[model samples]
Target chain A: MSSSSPEQLLAEIRHHCTQSWTLMEVCGGQTHALLRHGIDQLLPAEIHLIHGPGCPVCVTASERIDQALELAARPEVILCSFGDMLRVPGRQGRNLLAVRAEGGDVRVVYSPLDVLAVAQQHPDRLVVFLAVGFETTAPATALLARRALLAGVPNLTLLVCHVRVPPVLHAMLNAPQCQVQGLLAAGNVCAVMGQAEYNALAAEHRRPIVVTGFSAMELLQGILQAVDQLERGAHRVENGYRRAAAEQGNHAAQALIQQVFHPIDCQWRGLGWIPGGGLALREPFASLAVERRVAPPVSAPASPEQAQGCISGLVLQGLARPSACPHFRRPCTPEQPLGAPMVSSEGACAAYYRYQR
Target chain B: MCLAVPGELVSINEHHDPLWRTGDVSFGGVLRQVSLACVPEAQLGDQLLVHVGMALAVLEP
Candidate 1:
């Protein structure tokens, strides 16, 4: 509902940003949109925009990717995943693409539900969908689980790696090295999960949380709102993307998620394990979990970053820029990535390489 | 990845079970069948924010 133009919003941000304030945007899509539009360069020098660990592809544990690779390697298992996840390397630089090159059945799916069709077509094979995303994407997987269960599809299973935003936000703010003063919550996530958790986060951390959209104008408006709050010494949750996100969000989607999944301690690749940061299928839908059918190869104790000379941990924590990494462009190009950030399109490293570089 | 596109609902395929309802949404010139189970009240010509073949929210004008 922001009527202000991008120019007006930028001007307002400039007027209010009297002191240096570091703000982290907790969504990879938002990070890509900001860099794509050059919003970071357009902002005042005092307003530093740092990226958070929002890229689901970037945050997915390497062990999980290894498990996916293992599953895909099986002749009877058809592994399906989002396109961005295919290139992310697990331990020893192994990935799904490499498995596919070795004659493994790895398929890139546009939606999780697409696997149901694959399962239906090949009843002899096990169709496993590697579900990796935040709240915005979890609901779709939830719906898929519900439909598959209702239809009694026996061959379809899910490798659920869905993560939550609020817990990660709490983890980031609680870190000793955390420099983020305010946050621009992903609007798409807010559109589904609502603002209640963000409101609590703002109050607990004494920082403003502005639910922001993906457009350049919406990002600017969110920055202005955050700056306005910071300058006034007030901290609260503000909905800058009111057009799509409501205070309560889509009730039906939330209900579906609640019915199908629950939160549990899950590992983020670079950020380490955050309590209640990941989702797993609830008891009713427990039979749909891939792990229940086939045991995942027990991975070595997961290191923060799989590749040496990759500072993705710092990059994910908003402590270091992607370009600051020693192997950023030289050895870590997208074609030959050293970390998940470089592999994922929504990753900060990818955004920097695509835009700033 | 939380990227979602606002598409216009071109048509809805009603089913006996509301969860089975689907819609054809137009994203610019591209038309794709999207699940309308999330936004059951979505009508024709309504703008919807879709992600992963599912309509997540109805956009307000």
Candidate 2:
């Protein structure tokens, strides 16, 4: 058999799509990649690719954004976070970017550690870092926190939104609307946490979870591997990203994360709280925890303006597709994003908008 | 799993807040982000673990 193109793969999958498969990619990066590469359009109409809330910005609750904004407003605190997270809306439809526009000391940083250094060198400013992302990102925050404490960077604090992938997957599997036969796990997260966590989930759920790289070839491989497992009635964890991920992930990073963070309840945009699917800075590093210092004061914790006309939450939950949203293009463009998915570079809406629109 | 490799910090430049000084780390032809905030002592050419735009450490050369 010759190697398959995404077009070829989609054509073949369409043959079985009508009655059988619903492969969900559990990372927003994959969602962006698929849509940006036009992998979504290349696919046969029969097969479905559901987007997951792997985007740190898309899944982050409004209350957290408010807290970040509040931190940014303080004269001593310069709030730093991933750029896309800056645009995520809060209580009154305000976001970090909006707050920045209003002259708050908000800075966009690539890593949690960068803010730590700022905190260390400045000594005068409180560098309250907005820590976001999943297990793949938690390590950096953990390492940064440890480093800050070691360096006596008392001015730095972490606004942690570091989420866990496995528990969310577990929640999805148990959700009433759950409709997945296989998974394309975000490869970066596995690089930090390893594929071992997935093994137990696979054993329990009897669903194939293919750890995948961002490359198109790796994605194709992951999809094919998941299909093969489903076809063979075999449920297990497989790594299509072997070069970067091992059965045991980055042990050093894991050790850092374990030392600084403990599982806690986190609010997801659509999925709500999954009890222990998120992280909080442990007692030793509690000083770096932003959640402890700030209280989010949103009149209504759940606000509709925060969503606007965007059905991204539904798209993330697999209830709908980006194209399926009525306001996808007319109202939701990347420059003027109506939803968080359009706001972030890793967002499916942004990817689809940039590539397809 | 995309190859999230280690990058080397060359130098930092900032007036008020410090900017990351990590070298251009090639990742499958796409350059990734690493934070230069943690490695306070990282001089030019100090290798660091770069992930999702954050530098995790001053790694082995």
Candidate 3:
């Protein structure tokens, strides 16, 4: 929108887009940035910046939403989750927001703390919070779960859908066609895991792992650094966002996550299975875990319904980009999104539609 | 899973990681991290974006 912008620098970068540099951004927020600002068009097509499966909604398997719906419809269960999960269709056009519309007592709370107040107010209602998100969100959920235990609020229970950030990164690196040379590491995930984890990734993969921010300047600089490293045949961990992130991430939050959840192999939507990639509530908190209480997942994926055909899985896995998807805009607009990635405010395709051509 | 931004210190506790902090960060929702670490000297209303569990960086908001 102005002169002296990153646009001026774009042409120069494009010239160096390299014979083969498969650079991917590992956060869904970054996907929105690349698409929203039309940075995808601004950059050289030779440099493929694929969207990673960092979007929590995009990766949330079908069974989870079914459980949310089932629990929401229960008279005593007051389900709470972030706003994005509402639009995602689980089975038979049903979503948590739909459950709420049907008057099953579903409310949107900005923070996990809000659930605490709801528990305080309702005393008798079995308020089950649908806690879903990545490391950034895990702390709040962990804190609330702890608070529920300490306060002896038998009515308040959290259905943890918290996932880790690093294991997926590891999965991406190990893919067969994984020509990935670098990554714009999610700043927030790094904030929790700290710079320590990336050191191994960078060394193992021999790629520059630039912990990048979501700003225009931050992303531009991050791309430049990533490109620069690849061009020079260097591999290491770099911090594009150093102001808040340190060598050690939030230890207290880490401690909380450790106490509440244990690492387990979870199914990813596109990539299928990544061993030890997800987190589940610990045994001590078995009563709070939704999987423990829910009946067998009745609303499992149907044969024909299984093929949503959003291509978000391929797009997220870096095998395909949003523009390449024939259904990107036609079938999967943000308002009537066909998949979880498009449903969220941070969705890449939605951002591209709103800001990109 | 978590995304973090950086913040400045509003007030700190010599005994605990700062006890209180207040800042309007760029993140969605009324985001606040009640936890603090003493190694990173912070003051009242300093901004920090946190993810998973660590405070990543101070944002220029």
Candidate 4:
């Protein structure tokens, strides 16, 4: 806890709550933490918490999943990725796990570096690590890229689907369906990308953007800060998680990101394409990209379709809650996820299905 | 997902090239090897923001 404890922060939030305000927490980790600790229930009814598209797994474009499924199906290639991404269905109800069931060499690893060992052991096979995350995890992937390059690990390649926060936030604010008045930005993203990018967005949108951590007390403190700004009619970027994040974030990390990757137009599953929304390998490392090395036999990319009656797109845009989805609890439990939101551990629907409901 | 937590830097493995250094970070009792490439100034006993096995920033108490 900082100077103020969780109880004090909650009390201050209650005292400052004079009117109804809709605030969105942009990180799924924070969303789950809030629900887990019953912090949302502790807040005054005047404050509404809207979930944002901060879960990387939930926002991963369906086409990329199709591509991953194709790559994983290759007999000479060993596909590795985070655990949460394995079960998400892509097109025609096929996921990486399904490919694994068919004898595809799919392995779950905690970190990207773990893929290096697999590459070293199986020198004859191509080891492809699926890099999917925001700025918080980009540095790690960037480091891996550099390491693989330095080691001249010809057998190792990366399938990068790294997304940035600013452009996506810009998209949501410009969206007509979005009703968010204030935002609690993901602290770890700020810990890497810095608070400078958020300053302009907060100023343009006239909304308080507070960089927040993923804990009940830290989240409550962040919400309180957002509410205070809303009541005072202030639009500024604030740092509630000052312990780790700074105005000018880790510059070394930024430099590493600059050296390793470049931005490109990226398609989000529900939100569609955002200019400069995704990161691609730089010139020197382009040769180490899985997409560059592997050419699928298919003539065209698979056009994935969203399952009918799944309101995951609406839920991601904050237009509807998880419970509002017809199949949220019925046909779309964690055991059998109908959409990415239900499958991702940090997903809003999964959080609601597990904690809120 | 931009989920990261604070962990204590238990030890630093210095490479001939400083930027390639790494550290063993302990979150509660669980330990993981994290790249110190981002936070080159990070020292032993410093709290770091570990996400996806990379040290993003140093946490000052």
Candidate 5:
């Protein structure tokens, strides 16, 4: 790790930034940390930081949320998910909490393994874990799937909605309106999946990709590194959070994730579909998928945000600011969220609401 | 959500199968049981970056 302090890193960034440059931080956690610590404000006006669609809850397709609500409502099924997901609005403004309110056995779990315990306790009820996250959270869910399969926990099933970061970044950069000149990748995800994918992305897109952590110091260092690269007209992947991330990442976790899940084209709520963007259970583990047990509802082609008048799609793509939205603090407060971004703590909208507002 | 915390591994529950090994990790004063399946080489007192009850990586001291 660099010995430079946060102030030193900020100074370096300011000195390096001679021209206007737009950089997108591709993780909601980083976005939250940047705003929460006032790091964005501390940066030179030449360095523009745009938040990416890194919040899994914010990116999850409403069709999946509606399906989760459907599964939660089933009398014999107990649907469990992270608390961040419970408030995400689905079809007709319904959510998992609403299903729970109507006496559906929808439970909030801190960990995916907790769902295994819930399954063991209620042997008769089907426990479906709504697995949603990026590479960082995927390995844990993969471990859960492996453990369940090995221990013969037949009652538990996973509604896997885990996504990969690289493809989404590719989609974002490919967009005509994309203003991002460089990128700060999610460090925790890099800690698990490593920097190989990022190296490839950087070389292909010709943009600096810096793996960043969620601390003020780490975020500033990542910015400095990106700015330094941009100033030199050099594009490469740099590990700004070397303490947690590695070049190859955690091999054991990667092996387990590879053994259990395979890439599949999946939908992002507002971003639509991207090929190889999500993971699905493979072969023998496929039996543990919730879709095998319960039928999912046919969803409309339109994204939920369109119907709700939420411009989260544009916001997520870094084309619009959260505060610039007409519905930002009006009918779209956290108490009554019209979209998932407003509900998830890591979301840019929520960060803007809490800190920037 | 990819939120993880650095916690010190206070104790390990060794198992015949390495995949079943677990440990008690302390974050601040609170302690929770975390899976050590990924980091089978993890020893007691090692700081681990834990995410959703699983240790993804060991932080360098």
Candidate 6:
């Protein structure tokens, strides 16, 4: 299979390209891979790749960041989260790193369970872990919650913000402005939640959803499959990342997530509340939830003027590209990010800045 | 962060505490320690899709 190189795959894709096809890769990782390898440049002009709202950091609600910032300010609390999330600007331009600069005890953790060790060591203090991301990350946080329950760690609390892919895809497809003709599904997410959930969505929307991995060859192959499907007028769920993804996905991970988390209507930053879009701790693990312990200061929602010409909302919706934003390279570079898309490595703006721009 | 890379499990250490069971995962040539707490069923030489120092799923291939 390695002998049939990306060049060979590109030939196949070029042969199948007979019309204009606007496809959205649902994961930011794929977006980066495509740009890094120049796969997008190799594709036929008709095959337009639209970046989707797959970056967890880009889609995470600002209110949740405000809550994290509030928790980090407490003298008895130790806030832990992934590295990129620290720089994502919340409401009023404040972030966890900014709070840490002001003596807030916010630390970067490699894993959610690392906070469990922190909680064990500092029994007197509260260890609040920011649980974020899609299905790929949900299992890890859920496992941490179950372990916390089993270990009986009373000091650990989770600020949950897990999301699902299928629901958001459904919302995007149903939206009147959506121009996406096909999709490259997030492989890691499908590895946990399985591909069955996408079947109905594919049939209903009449758009092929191909589950793909991060490698350039995998993505090119996925795009090839999607384009072929579009050409044939066949809309179904295809597994291009068969080596890691399966039809049913990881059942053990799914079971663990189900035990620890329940679906809730959660708000996405650029996109508003999506029904059953996010996850919160289930009743059994409610005590470990951070929202119950700390009351976040509710600031007024961000105004259009406050967004400061950052069209991340349009970018996330695939209506506009990152470079299309007026402030994209001018004031919204990764070093001085005006939005989460610039701060997070997986964000579309960051990917475009590093590669295309 | 939803970004995860596929790594090959080199070995599994059963001597340590079971809850903290760990294995050495090699992504291409880079090696790192990953927790097997979530995937207790993971065996030696398994390809795991690792995220944030934890093996979230085992690749069938």
TM-score of chain A of each: 0.97, 0.91, 0.91, 0.96, 0.98, 0.97
Candidate 4 per-residue C-alpha lDDT over A46-102 given as tens digits, one digit per residue, 9 for 90 to 100:
999999999999888887787888889989989999999999888556789989999
Model 6 root mean square deviation, Cα atoms:
2.0
Q: Distance from true position, residue A164, model 5, in Å?
A: 0.4
Kindly state the fnat score of candidate 6. Answer: 0.67
Instruction: Record all residue pairs in model 6 with backbone atoms less than 3 Å apart, i.e. clashing.
Output: none
Q: What is the TM-score of chain B in candidate 5?
A: 0.95
Give the fraction of native contacts in model 5: 0.79
User: Could you give me the TM-score of model 1 versus the true structure?
Assistant: 0.98
lDDT, candidate 2, at A189:
83
Cα lDDT of model 3 by residue, A231-281, tens digit: 888899888866555668767667778887888898765567878878888
Q: What is the DockQ of each candidate?
A: 0.89, 0.17, 0.34, 0.81, 0.87, 0.64
Comparison by lDDT, 2 against 4, better one: 4
Sort by DockQ, top down from the best: 1, 5, 4, 6, 3, 2
After superposing candidate 2 on the true structure, give the runs of residues whose Cα lies further than 4 Å from its correct spot.
A1-19, A291-302, A305-309, B1-49, B53-61
lDDT for every model? 0.90, 0.73, 0.70, 0.87, 0.90, 0.87
User: Please, what are the lDDT tens digits per residue for candidate 4 over residues B6-41?
Assistant: 899999899987567889999998988888888888
lDDT of 4 at A29: 89
Q: Write the per-residue lDDT of candidate 6 for residues A90-112, one digit (tens) a residue.
A: 87777888899999999898888
Highest DockQ scorer: 1
Q: Runs in model 6 with CA error above 4 Å?
A: A1-3, A301-306, B15-21, B27-31
Worst 10 residues of 6 chain A by lDDT: A298-307
| Candidate 6 residue A215 C-alpha distance from true site, Å | 0.6
On TM-score, the stronger of 2 and 6 is 6
Better of 3 and 4 by TM-score: 4
Superposition error at A218 for model 2 (Å):
0.5
